[model samples]
Target: MNTNKELEYCNVAVWFDRSTLHAMMQALVEAGLNVAWKESQKQFRVTVYTQHGTSDLTLLRLNGAYKLDELDYCVRDMRLALVLYQFIEQAKGHAIVKMMNQDKIVVKNIRYGEAVRIVEIKGAEKKVIYEKACSVTMDQVIAALKRRDAEERIPVMRLELDYELATLYDAIQAKDTAQVKKSKDRLKQLRQEMLLLEA
Candidate 1:
């Protein structure tokens, strides 16, 4: 808890899931912040240089939580941290929109029919039927948006399970115990989550 903000670093941690954490890191990187992922520590080190001084922030993940560390608590550093937080919030919104769009699929099912009598439709027609059957009213839409806003939301990362499994295999072949263990745990968790999502 160094209060001296000038030319110093401070660290804080905020709770975030893997995707939100990754989005924040990506946003910091896009904003020209020097960011590095410390794999061993499961944290991100962010350094920002200004004309007056240098500031740093570290994001650590632990027990499915996240925390941010700032180098200093000076006005400048506080301002920078605020900006970073805003950027993260913006990124989170973007991620939510992306996830919603990706998950929004045209429901294709028979309205009323047996196996012998059915119709397959997609796109606008499917949407119409779905909206009618589900009674997706304005209140529901509002409620859904509220739920999304309140949730710790993140877009699905591009990283695929197959790629992660392959990396795990490589780690095993290389006899990298730490990596093998990490990858195996991640793959197991991710696979379970994916199955749940699919269900």
Candidate 2:
């Protein structure tokens, strides 16, 4: 991995049932959606990668009524206001959710239920969810910042690198073997390369 580089997002895939996937895909196609990627399995369900922001994958679950355990995974973005609204309208029944991620977007429902046209994001909305649901990653944010900075960077990184190098030299003199081995060597080289890039 290039330590200096970053990425915006990964290939997010949406999963649901075969019938529901087919229906949504059909609706999207009719709505003039250009699907980026998709695959289906009757034994399991359907997974799709879309060109748009997020795809609806509501029908995949049969509620707690299914023979499976933790059926909430059937609904991907159950926390997303629009997705939740639509899913609730589609699923019709009060959807069961085992876990919801930080973004309130992707959810892990162990069960699924009936299908319809999702009504509102929160005929089933809740407050005080976990931070783990959806939060910006350090690397992703850093990558975005670096992308904006390009080769010539800002004063803060300069200060951080200077502080790191000083700390590295101090550890070397103090014979802090663990810090020397873990941080000093790689950090020194990387900082020097970055400094040269800056100059």
Go through the candidates in order and give each one's C-alpha lDDT: 0.44, 0.38
Given candidate 1, what's the lDDT at residue 18? 66
lDDT of 1: 0.44
What is the C-alpha lDDT profile of model 2 across 1-199, one tens digit per residue? 2222211111122223345445554655554444443322313222334332544332223321111112233323222323433433353223433333333333322111322112112225654332323233566545555564532343344445557778778889999988778666666555444433332
lDDT, model 2: 0.38
Worst 10 residues of 1 by lDDT: 92-101
Per-residue lDDT for 43 in model 2? 31
Q: What is the C-alpha lDDT profile of model 1 across 84-145, one tens digit per residue?
A: 54543433211110101222432222111101112223434432432223323565455445
Model 1, TM vs. native: 0.31
Deviating ranges (above 4 Å) for candidate 2: 1-21, 30-44, 51-87, 96-199
